[model samples]
Target: AMAGLTTIRGLVPAIPHAPVAARMPSEITSREVLFVKSLDALQRRSQLSLRGSNLAAFAGRRTEDERSRLKRVRNKEDRKQAFKDFRAVATVVSALFAGLAVYLKYSDSELLYDFDITDDAVSIIAGLLFAISFQYSSPLQLLLVFFGKFETERPADWVAARIAGVDDPKAMTEYNAPAYAQVLSTALIGALGLVTASSLSKLGDTWSLSTAVGTAFLSFLYEVGRPKRLSSEEVVAREEQWSDFRQFAEARLVKAGSCHESEIFDAFVAAFPQYRDDTEGKAAFKQLRRFVYQWNPTAERTPYGFYKNVALSSTFEKGKTSALDS
Candidate 1:
């Protein structure tokens, strides 16, 4: 009987087993589904927040890079404009001096209005001579030639050394040439004017004090008004750069086997640090290496060889040519 009862109980479904409809929770009918939807919405919001942060970081980096590029371009333009402005001012001053010279030459009776000669004939001859000599080989032309020669034939190592503030006698010699030339030219011109005045006085022709004063003033103006005479601020800035260059050059010389190439490269690099990353620097360095190591046998020899050679050879050649012509 018990076995039969057990069988009947097994045939009955368990109390916990219910229809799917009856198993549904009252919470689903009330607010449980809404809570689940809210949870899904919160998860989506979190994902969007992370994506926004990443985008913002990317944008910030891009902005910084753009700012850096723009600043560099602006700085380059400013430097170019400054150089142009300086050149323009120099050109205007030169033009004014030239005009004064022309006026003086034209107004002088000896130059343009000789008493014995017809005005038109004398003026034409004087004008032609003046145009040929003074106009063609003017101060501006000389200045340009001087700088051109300096930039070309001048030893790059010498300039690099000067920029580095090297104290070697050779370096000083190289540095002083340009200044010497300027002073020499001024003195020579002044002397020529004086000689001309003396000759005129001997001929019983007097020149006004105003003319002499004007000649002196022109010489002074040309010397002082030159672009090479830097402003106080520019001098200070260059001196600071020179100090840095000297330090860097010294350090570099101590390295790289203490060779001349090393010294030259170090000086050049310090003078033009902006070129450190460029192919120009590499080429310069290579050339410097050849100059110091291959061309020069004695590294201890002063760097004044080229300058001395040019000065001596040119002087001798000029003397010989002058004698021959005479």
Candidate 2:
């Protein structure tokens, strides 16, 4: 059926070549059987039919591109899962290996003698365990201190804004510690663990220290290569300042009975000179929007994207005048 272009006659020579069905009745003549010549022709027919469907292009059913894209996404997800699985397995295996080495050092096991497990090998394994401790310390901080300021917490306003469909905000809280400080802490704690374990296993200091330093260097190299995205204390300070600005803007908007973004920014800058130097006025604009969207009860957004002061705009004034006249 998928063979290259060929006529019915060529496909089946036993059929009559008279371009009519020989098995048809004498009164009615049989029409020549029409068939697709090849797989490409069949594909063209299927595509044509699909294209003729309602909104086929918009519905995205005609193209293989979407399917190909989905397959690529699935492949990437599979690769990611594989890496995670491998990491988990490596972690478990390393822990078990370190435990066995430590046990062999303490116990006069015949298996240690049989396997020729030397003191240097046990020291290296212990060092590797220390390196693993350092590798895991940053995340371990999360486990130890639940409220450690790591910039991973969602701000109240950010979450509210997302729920209101205003914006998709990133977690941008201030970190209490710098990257180097955190890294130093990890090293200190890992070293402490190594020293503590040395008491139990009585590891050879020379071999253990060398392996520990080498493994620690390599592990920390990966950490150093990662891009630092430190959220500053200034972010929290600025957000606090924005809260004050929101109050100021809301008061001004309510007092004026109506205003646009520029008017609000001008008034805000007059009150708080710190925002005056902001050339883009992005912060001021965000505050004003917050006031209009969430803060003010009587504030109504105008068609032109400004607010109409329900109490002070021209429409309100005219209505007041008409009521007085009546």
What is the lDDT of every predicted structure here? Answer: 0.41, 0.48
Q: How many clashing pairs per prediction, in order? A: 0, 1
Candidate 2 weakest lDDT stretch, 10 residues: 151-160
The TM-score, computed over Cα atoms with residue i paired to residue i, of candidate 1 is 0.25
Model 2 stretches astray by more than 4 angstroms = 1-174, 177-230, 255-258, 290-304, 308-326
Backbone clash total, candidate 1: 0
**Residue-by-residue lDDT tens digits, candidate 2, 1-326:** 32333444355534544555556654443222333234346766766776765454554453456557856876676567446633643454355456656776677867664432335555546545553544433334334345643333222223333444444344433322334443343344444444533543554446555555554554444334433332444357457666866676545444334445565566667777766433224545665666556555566666665565423234344554222223
lDDT of 1 by residue, 1-326 (tens): 43544454454434323474267676643354455455556656667887988876786687668668966976676577546534533443344435544665567556433332122333223322222222113434445654652212222223334445555424233123354343333333333333344333334323323333443344344434433323344446445545544454444332112222343555567667753643335545545533443333433323532211111122344443222223
lDDT of 2 at 131: 38
Error of 1 at 267 (Å): 58
Q: TM per model?
A: 0.25, 0.28
Candidate that scores best on TM-score: 2
Which regions of candidate 1 deviate over 4 angstroms? Answer: 1-33, 108-326
